[model samples]
Target: MTQGPIRLDIAVGYATPRKGLPSAVSFRRWATAALAGRIREADLAIRLVGSKEGRALNRHYRGKDYATNVLSFPADLPEGLPPGVRMPLLGDLVICAPVVAREAREQGKSLNAHYAHLTVHGALHLLGWDHEDSREADAMEQLEREILAGLGLDDPYALPGD
Candidate 1:
């Protein structure tokens, strides 16, 4: 069944310099693509941070020392809401600009494309998609590939010779 357009109220915040970074519109587009057909409405925040803040958040949240790429924080809605009440608050996404740039350069991919992939990946995470195990990882990766392809981007997980 075809679903209607997703109603997204995405707030983009830049904790780092805006220069050489993807604009808020691009992020919103990527997020909407990820949410379309899966959700009807959403309210989420996407924060772009520098390496320092990214590293700190990663360390504090995931116990990782360095900043990875994108971090997804799903919303924790309050309990005791009336039945049939759906919360449109989808949590926040933190993207480390430096890490993304570095990875793009290292992987020989365009910066904008990398950002799109990360944004989509993070959005899926917000929707309760996880890759804690191999099976889950494969499914998530395939979904990501499909979403990116729909966005006219190359497969992010493709090998060098593929």
Candidate 2:
């Protein structure tokens, strides 16, 4: 099915002078690219945050105390909307800049590439894709690989020891 245009919003809340943070244009590009052929329309927000805020959100929401790379919060609209109602709001993404940067450096991946992968990954999650099990993980990872490749990025799952 043909997809429609995308509407993305981005916010940066980190105080640290981090390097390699993607621009709003790049975020839009990555998100729109990931949503291509998947959703006809999307209204999503991407928020770049520090480890403190990221950790707080993780702890409150997922019961995890550490800051993660990316967290997805899908829209919780009613299952059945009234007639003529269009819920284009997909969800929000909270990306910890420091964590992403550190992971990219440690994993030997480019910062932009890692950000692209995470953006795509979070977008997928907003669209109801998940990796809760081996089968689901394989499928999600395959899709992520395809999406990242389309953006001229390498497979994010490749380990350095491979």
Candidate 3:
């Protein structure tokens, strides 16, 4: 079955020069690709933030002190909506550019590939995918590998010793 179009908005909140930031078109493409065969429609925001904002968000929401890669905030729609009601608002994805770049360098992965993986990962989380346990992590990683492979990207989970 064909899915409805996705509406994605990208926001840059960092003050530093975003040297390797992905274009809005690329963000939309990656998100749409991730959402394929999963949802009919999506309305989400991708916010690029600096380490400060990232850390603040993570601490406030997740109780972590340091900045992480990506944070997914799913929308909480009211329950008991009438049948046939469409909830297009999926939620927001807050990505830390510095953290992502650092991870890419440390992991020996390309910047673009790392961004793609995080984008897909964040989108999956918004779509109700999680890795709170080993089984869930395996399923999520497999799906991530499949989606990234379709985009000609290497498996994000591949370790150096593998």
Candidate 4:
């Protein structure tokens, strides 16, 4: 892990009503936790969106016609940056507020905790983490659990009655 405080530049936007969503500060905190041991510094954006916008983005990008919880779009930097240079531009995250709310309710989880988990998950994705296979999924989930635990949250992948 890199030493020193992580320099983070985060922009949070709301395309949906912000009445029940997490604050920008909270999102930044979650992202910071996710990147704590993984990255030294980064720039990213988190956009809270309604179902319609979320669905359209999912459809257009992933070809899925539903609004998923969170979508990560990593930064596509230029091909040739000189040596010894680092890009702080990590990527962007799109969170479906409604979907997240519904999932929290269905999973019997605290709303804030769920948001924190998703924010961490999205940030990990921005750092090139993925769950395309069973092994990768397990590793990523373990990391997420550790991050969330650091934030005083329960294991997000635990079963309801476990």
- Candidate with maximal lDDT: 1
What tens-digit string does per-residue lDDT give for candidate 4 at 96-147?
9999999999999999999999999999998888999999999999999999
Worst 10 residues of 4 by lDDT: 77-86
What's the lDDT for all of these models? 0.92, 0.84, 0.84, 0.91
Q: After superposition, how far is residue 115 of candidate 2 from its true place, in Å?
A: 0.4
Superposed Cα RMSD, model 3: 3.8
Candidate 2 residues lying further than 4 Å off, grouped into runs, are 1-19, 77-86
RMSD of 4: 3.0
Residue 96 lDDT in model 4? 98
Model 1: per-residue Cα lDDT at residue 142: 97
**Backbone clashes in each candidate structure, one number apiece?**
0, 0, 0, 0
Candidate 3 local lDDT, 21-125, one digit each (tens) = 877677777887898778777677888888999999999999999999999988754453347745676888899999999999999998889999999999999
What lDDT would candidate 2 get against the real structure?
Answer: 0.84
Q: Which of 2 and 4 is ahead in lDDT?
A: 4
Residue pairs of candidate 4 with colliding backbone atoms: none
Quote each prediction's TM-score.
0.91, 0.85, 0.86, 0.92
Name the better of 1 and 3 by lDDT: 1
Q: RMSD in angstroms, candidate 2?
A: 3.3
